[model samples]
Target: MSMDINEVPSVDPKEEPHAAPPRGNLRKYDPLDMESASFSTHHGQAAKATDWMTILQLAFQSIGVVYGDIGTSPLYVYSSTFTDGIKHKDDILGVLSLILYTITLLPLIKYVFIVLRANDNGDGGTFALYSLICRYAKVGMLPSQQAEDAEVSNYQLDLPNNRFRRASRVKSTLENSKFAKYLLLFITLLGTSMVIGDGVLTPCISVLSAVGGITQATSAMTEGRVVWVSVGILICLFVVQRFGTDKVGYSFAPIITIWFLFIGGIGIFNFVNYDPSVAKAFNPKYIIDYFRRNKKDAWISLGGIVLAITGTEAMFADLGHFNVRSIQISMCTVTFPSIILAYMGQASYLRTHMEDVGETFYKSIPGPLYWPMFVVAVMAAIIASQAMISGTFAIIQQSLSLGCFPLVKIVHTSPKHEGQVYIPEINYLLMLACVAVTVGFRTTQKIGNAYGIAVVFVMTLTSALLVLIMILIWKTHIALIIGYVIIFCSVELLYLSSVLYKFVDGGYLPLAFAAILMVVMYVWNYVYRKKYTYELDNKVSPHKLKEIADNLNFHRIPGIALFYSELVQGIPPIFKHYVANVPSLHSVLVFVSIKSLPISKVPQDERFLFCRVEPRELAVFRCVVRYGYKDFHERDSFQEILVDRLKEFIREEQWISPPTISSNGDVNGNAMDNGEVTNEEEEIRRKEIVGREIELVETEYNAGVVHLLGENEVVASQGSNIGKRILIDYAFNFLRRNLRQRDEVFDIPHKRLLKVGMTYEL
Candidate 1:
């Protein structure tokens, strides 16, 4: 059973207060002690037993949340591949083989079997991989981390010894290098940014491709009309994001399920009726023969061929929302077979009716099911967009919590689901970008290329991160790691090279988006580091805090004030800003610092680290509140919980005070018969002393609580270089100013808040 250190035994308050111990005698609080910390706020519960019904229910639910994006890929895979137009009979079998292998190898084998299990606790993504690597190594860029953080419940891992010299050297090298840390962060952010790019292009292409089916159904439906319709649908899809995914998951799962069933049913019909020879494409020879027949075109067509597994990353990225089993079960049983059959069925149709290559997906749809398929296709496209949008929100949320991205407003749309977040700024921005792609490109082929670029690049990054995980985290053998890297890298790089080849033809879009977001992330992280460094270097000493406490002119007001700090220890310079300007502070001042740890979830009991500053009569305390990326801070009751925990800390500290040994093994302010206080009588005396302190705190508890935050801004000094000036003054500052109200992020009430305005120059 876990210990709650705050559950100190009650003591009688009728006795006298103990005399204060000498400055050097008291036991300084150790925040690193895993046994003593306790918190009132509950983040998440532990996993429960997984019965068959629960697994089946979650598996069905995973269809909507996890597989939407990948399931919709069939709408455009064949169409995109034949953009130059499918001219040869062998090309049909070849393209189908490429699609089958790409889907079979990457998503089904690499992701479902390997990468899904690599999740940080229940979380997964590029960030999760990064988090996993960070836990096993000292490569984390966050400054406030301690050695004890590694031993936390979720982040804990046993390391291989120095006997494995190569691995040891590699780990040491990665930990020691500043460049390596930043590079890893840059790469992770790039992957996340590409997912944002996916958010933009996936909707455009999916919707456009789905709506294009109308062109086949009727002569009146023009490409222009289809584009407009797609844009409208994209608008609707993004607007409803405020409602949250959990609210709509039930509805979306059925549509996607029925859509998959319809496509699979049609696939069986076509394979049986049109060309059973399409089954031969499942063999590796056709993929080789297609390349052998048309080498250059085959290489370039890989840009198109990769559309088969476009949104497969979403399956892995959204693993936090849906577990690995449900995703794997849904994909293997339904999504995977349905999509494979859909492509094979398309291939079968293409062998005989070669003229309909561009419209093969729609044309191949059995005539009776065409209209129903189009409607389901549209719904599936919308569902696909919804999944990517939710994923974008999650990635941004993680980035924000990790301090890599500028602050943005995050709304938890569902009370029950912690991960179901919606970002208005990101949503509207994505909508505009999606609309622009549809308006400008107006064709699925160009948009498909852009989408392919985003998808393949994210895959490549995931593969790169996985190699490090296989080495450091999993501690796999060197031979196995090398083989994993080579195989995955070769395939991903092939697709990556194909996408890069089309840079001039719509592929530049995702690249541009990635570059822009990378710059934003890099700049924000740069400013964050500089600001953190300043706080660390310029912190107020314990002597200075004592002096502040001793001075009478700095009036102590009647309420409890929670002063927010960026530093884990010592006083932040922002406190200096406030003290210099203001004549008074609260009667009880609590220095509060919130840190995001590399772990997925910091257990509630271990969340807050409370330490009492010297001269307890002055009522000053410091708290370090830690959270993982997935942990959501409940805004409404956080202050109340924090105050209650503070009360608990004070009581616990008071109770532990006299019994705690001083230097040379003597108990502070107590007589030691033989280097220790005598048993029963001394214990009762200590209890009486603690009860007195509790009463004092109870008197101050009647006072209200106020929150203090720093309104910090970054500026480039005049003497700085033009490059620095442009980055800090223009780019980073603009994003900081316009993104969100940083003060609002804490959800502190305006009336009870104190904002100490400050500026820093680089």
Candidate 2:
């Protein structure tokens, strides 16, 4: 007797170690399930059974991931500010006041309080903001998006109503305008590229500044020797990136904790013994007075002063690793106060020892404590660079999934931590760049200039993007959005101007990096869009496919074949190319399209959508597998899972609409005759028949799943402009050739994969 697909035996939830709890009524409310044809309770929000130990562990883990970059700022901020020279008494108070307010406003007020709320579910970064905007508006750059993409849990937003309907206007404009969407993407990519530049500069400057402290310990230490030492340290840091951060990641918080306590303790000692009166610098009047007295000198000094907030962006970017309360409590109770006291201590010590301005961090240390503090400083610097490198990997991984970057091999270093990914190519490139900058600059002064540019520009871009989120996505009042733009943009643009003034003094490095990376992104996107349009225009219809399947001489092979492409609907033209040459096809054909949506995670139950291509016994079907940028594929046997899901889908479909044998002796359900049903009705009816039952024919287990992938070479058409030809033929082609293959990217085994090569002229 035939059985229902749902009756098929499978692993029990209690036995499945990773199975989530039953959803009960919660599945009814999930937007992802609401839009899909069916739903399962697989990916449910189970009540987490956690104790105090778990919370404490998360808090501790957060310090290492979130605060490492900012915690090490004390190593270099002072030296960079006094690089040009500072006045004896007044400059110290003014700079101290600037640093105090910069930290308070940017990291504490802006990031922790405001920006963290804008996270994509739990993930945070420039791309997170871009994804949020995409959901609210139809501005995603991916051409293959479907209506189901907006059904993800985090993608839900309030529809425009009579009360705050103005947001609809903004959304309409963005969605209708391709240029606006592309421009926003460009800004986001620019910010992302600068963050990678930060990864390069953060190590060179932070390590060099920390190691330079040894100069005061002994006269034998020279600037030349310090550069080499810093380079060696950077080499070691990047060298270990492949091993992943899981082993040392936990130690990060404790190391930073000790460093903060050490700096805070030293600050108190210096404050009490050297100059208690420097406490008055906490007042805003010092900032005002310093600027009035110094004029243009103070304006230029703002570039260096901004260094106090160098790794501030990391506070927001790494929010996915820890909760907001943990970060807030850690920052407010420990990091903020410790950093403030450290700066105050430096200002107080500088009151007497003006000559030690260049090495204030080390020189201000009490003679007995210098060696221990020096060791902590180096450790903190290593942690700082490590945080930056990891953050870069996460952002680039997001970029790759979104089609904004080339395919690269991603290795998950920690099985327990989903976010811990290591990219070998990126690690190697970053290492070389860090060492080159360290050897070339030979001092923190120039690297600081470049570092300042990267930090402020990223901040400025974030500020600009926040305006759109506030107005368009959040639907805040017009007056409030305008006010936010004015306040934040003015501050960031002020810092941008100061950094730009030092353009010749190493500020050009990040700008050059951003430009080169931006060009590569634009060229790749241009070619990708062209190829996508070509596929859509050349797609084969069901009528033509039926004709091919019905031909008397058509050859059919055994086993199931899954043909993968970027197309969301219809058979890809590449299939025709493959069949025309081979003159044969698999008995069971499934066209699968894997898409990365603009959200952080897609529910496992809602990830795959199956549909029948036509009403025929040919066993042709289509499947769309959707994933979010942060989603990780299960490491078990994907073939078994796919087959099970397919069987379940067929059973469900059969229960809903049983198939009938048609005149052609093919299994068909409610087959549409010519002109019998409207095209729209037929489409709706086709969706209803997706899960109809068909017998599952067994095949040799080893050779069962064959993945057919298209290998297409893209080239510009003849008579194209020199620029277009060069970009398409040389630059884009070069990147495509070096990128990882499709089978490797999707974890398809080489033995069962078949390549069908085709060339497209655009």
Candidate 3:
């Protein structure tokens, strides 16, 4: 049977109803604690501009954070494209034509117009797209998803029944085929890894290219000095990342704004003075003519020509920080026109002075403005690097939330900006890699070769994923989908092929980085799945719990204990192992499961879900806390919020039922009939019982609270093959030991925490 798109089963329900009243077990709390808890039905939607002033402000801020990388492309595109020297003035127009068409088609039309609309509740990037697909289908491998996850504000999608029927078929094919699922995951990871690679290369190339202009300004500075100077600037740039993007954007907005104006003004000057004839490059015919005349040389030159759109992917990846309209406004108004003007000016300059092709940007500058523009160019380059670095952090955060990457310490740097994050581990590693690449490559040409490969590969993967999204999520028409694939994918593939040709000449660098990152991501996800599956198979059942309680001399202690596990439905096997080793149990037990949903933020009112486990007299309950990938959890407040919610649940349950006597003179805990009891008397009795239960919960909570965490050791099964041993015993274990642990992630107080050791052979 096919499931409706909205009917895909959640891993576990928010609340399960009970048919019977609670047994008179004074030691146990009320069984209907979850029934009265509030669950907000509010659906998350993308942020929108409410007024023109806000839109204008966001657009201004976006120029720094969103357009930095693409805006700075004017610095090197002309020089990189004509690395072999311009043979004819027409070659300049041909390359300019290619640049114009690429920016217009890819960034302006494809991403801003179409792909931006595909964002997952304002969140974008390869992982966000994958997240949307996962939500619509049962393709996600993670086992901890909860039914409450779909209720997250941004997780809801409204589709007509007819569209859903078509989407369901697409979803069915992916769910039924294991290979297809893996392929989709692999493609997403490949794109994510490339974006991470972009993080490293962007800083190296941008700073290096901008700093290289020093040699043109003064003959005194050598290439070696330029490399060191670039390294120093990169170190400073990465160091300031801890201040977060909000501050960075505020500071950078003016520099990038001025830089764009300067470049555009210079382009206009050069166009009028040298060659207004270069304006013919705006025509698409020149693109065909340029390739027709140059043939092999033109095809190879595309490797460098592709650099013009290096930062286009950032527009989508960083969409979580700024709304679509603001980004679109920034791009069309300031970014697009300025870049076009800058390139036109460079082409005009190159038309007259072909020999200056080596230092096109610096040489074209008027003598009076040379030093001033150079300073702005370097700062602008740093801003461009900032965009990619921020994008890398965002994608990695998404990957970690989905369990594809190993756990790392993620610090949400801005309380106001949900997407502004700082990852210390990734930041330092990227710094080292960027500095190393800058020092080693020492020139924009070689670094540009590597940069093009990463950029096009990510773009091509995006196009491929977008095709599936159109079919499965958007339910776009077959004809429109076909046209999209043909136009965007064809252009991306052309660039991909060209960049691949330079594999031996520095293109291998990003691919090597991507390969290592991809393996790390895949292995972490693989081991995570195996470990979860083992837990699921070996989970402790209610009957098993009864047996353990009866035979193991189990005795209830005087405090509340929270047992943390990955499972959402049943008691984790680690709890059984803990009981086997230690016979005593806490007076109240809560199986706490924390999960990250794919959306950007879970509403505060809907963050916690309470469910009562069976045999409620044992005082056992389950609490599931859900967070969006962008949500920040305050370590100290968790205990307080949980306690407050539990108390509220207790008070609510008392009012739901009032004490009543049966014919045999037993307290049946049912409502009293109007004739049997006065309304005032019943109200007093209800308040008394409610007060008693509330006092009991508070006393027990004050006694003590302990956090129980599982410290699991995963290994290949005894009879497993060599491949499993290598992956599980060596690779997975090494990463698990080196990366962040569960205790650290949750930030549980060390004095109140207990570790339960268990072994999983999977």
Candidate 4:
């Protein structure tokens, strides 16, 4: 039943699973009969589940979650370039070069290369990147790197007695790493802000712009109703947040899937109609020609030109779910080539048919009904905002689990769906912000003012962070990256300049909102870190396991008890709470502490450590679970296995007395052997009433007994008859303090102050 200290367990697939039986019901324990804890039936190559198919699904889902913001760029890009064509043409060419470069370079190349690689798993986004980087601070990355000290593990394991070798070895990585914690905090704050900004901005811009497109198509829809319609659409969008993506997400994937095809089809039709030379939009020349023909409006054009890159952040955000290879394949095969053809096709259509203008060019397609397209486009935008909001919620969910946010209610949408998250408070906050944006802005024309600033701010920060990560992580030189980022930042700055000019025009609000959000994220993290992370840390005893093993007579649980620890202790201190509190002595199991090793090698066998706490079935045990980024999940982990084993051990042990009910509601408490209330204690309580934790002399609420049993304390709170109390008090105090001038009896500070003022002291 005990593991040998000299032998190392294999982490290999061939190793059989070790099962711990429950003390009571054997059925409760998982029959770990498998040779190894491998879950490869659904993964890896033998499963026949190609990464490409998953990648494609992930890519299409990204479009559902991400495409609208980027997809709508067609509304303004060609227009921006067209209007700019009337001005200085030289800078236009440069700007055009910049646009092509941003599209091709950022979304296509750099995002696919550097940013997506940082995904925690299939959840790529700013928050994912934040998590990836913050692991240093999260796992005490910096302290582990530099410090001699070790943080302790909070959880205890239920493995049968054995000297844990592999577990101890792996659990040594983040012993005292403070850098991981700090870096995680910093990155989380940044990511939370960007996510929140995107959440609010997405619905406002996406739906409003689609409405703009729709209104242009249909003349009956009035301008004043635009705000109302936009607000309604936003409310509907926020309402769907609770349901999770599995419900409405399927519809969007199909719609967006069709939308892309429609875009391709339209491009083909227009290409056949216009100067086939327009096929050169992909050549990066027409984008050049627009600027060449006119340059005076380069800054303004650049402002609108940035819209095309709206989904650029989304591309990076989704790097986790799909392989980089698949995203590139989609871009090359479906998204990119199609996008170029469409834009060129649209531009070509405009070139020849300027005089023969239809009400909306989007509507002029030959065979189909255009109104439905507008509606679907609106749905796409709603989905876009939904994706942003969902991403925000997901980030906050992870952030909260990491102890970075105030506990907001998080209701998971599906047991099987990891990404199906819903946070009501966030949804409402974003909804309110979005609806306000709709009401205040009125149209996409005004909404655009609130748009570009977010991209510039986030992208600027992203580029800056990338440079840092690349320099620090990849050990690449930062100078060249700094120069390139600076150039892009400067370009972004000029774009922001145009946006700022539109502040009075409606842009200042989102900037203000984003700033407030950033501050909130920082404040939330700062307050929690300062107030809580260290609260339990110092309270726990460091030298606990050896002491527990030495003190056999010490009271403990009958079976294994696993308490999740933030601390990295050999024997978690929570077990000490039991020794000090419980009268029974049984066995103890501490996981010791978990840590990752420098080597990325997967061990031949998985169980890290096995150690004896005491003797036989009454013994204490320990295990240390190690995991990597790809290894994160709610289920399927060494820690979860430990929980299962602990439960099993507890059930199998008969030392644990069955829950015996008292006449009064009580569980764990200091009591007499017979469990009878002592009248002598009642007398002592009346005598000792003068002393209490919180003194309640008299209150609006009933002054019930603030009970104090030795280890436990609670207020027996009762409501006061506020009406009768206030009425009588007000009359009595008025008569005594006001009429009779007995100010002390009045007991109202302001009234007493007024009397003093009336006394006219020099």
Per-model TM-score versus the true fold: 0.91, 0.90, 0.91, 0.62
Full-model lDDT for every candidate: 0.78, 0.77, 0.82, 0.49
Per-candidate alpha-carbon RMSD to the true structure: 5.7, 7.4, 4.5, 16.7
Off by over 4 Å in 2: 1-52, 655-666, 669-694, 697-703
**Judged by lDDT, which candidate is best?**
3
Task: Give each model's clash number.
Answer: 0, 4, 2, 70
Candidate 1 residue-wise lDDT, 156-182, digit = tens: 666777667676777888877989987
Better of 2 and 3 by TM-score: 3
Which digits, one per residue and each the tens of the lDDT, describe model 2 over residues 354-462? 8888888888888898899899899889888876787788788777756788778777777765666788989989999999999999888899999999999999888
Which TM-score value belongs to model 4?
A: 0.62
Model 4 RMSD in Å is 16.7
Candidates 1 and 2 compared: the better one by lDDT is 1
What does the lDDT read for residue 717 in candidate 2?
90
lDDT of 3 by residue, 1-762 (tens): 112335533222212322233421111223232112333335454555458886787788888988889988888887888888898768888999999899899999999999999887778899999988888776877766644466566777654366367677887889899898899999999999999999999988888889988888689999999999999999999999999888888899999999999999999999999999998998888888888889989999998889999899999998877778899999999999999999999999889999999889999999999999999999999999988898999899888878899888888877766888888889999999998998889888899999999999999999888888898877888899989988999999999999999899899999999999999998999888788778877888768866865674778888889999877656788988998788888887888878788777777867776655655446676777878788898699898788776666555444233345333333444534547755566556656655665686688799999999988999899999998899999998898998889899889999999999998989
Q: Which candidate model has the greater lDDT, 2 or 4?
A: 2
How do all the candidates rank in terms of lDDT, highest first? Answer: 3, 1, 2, 4
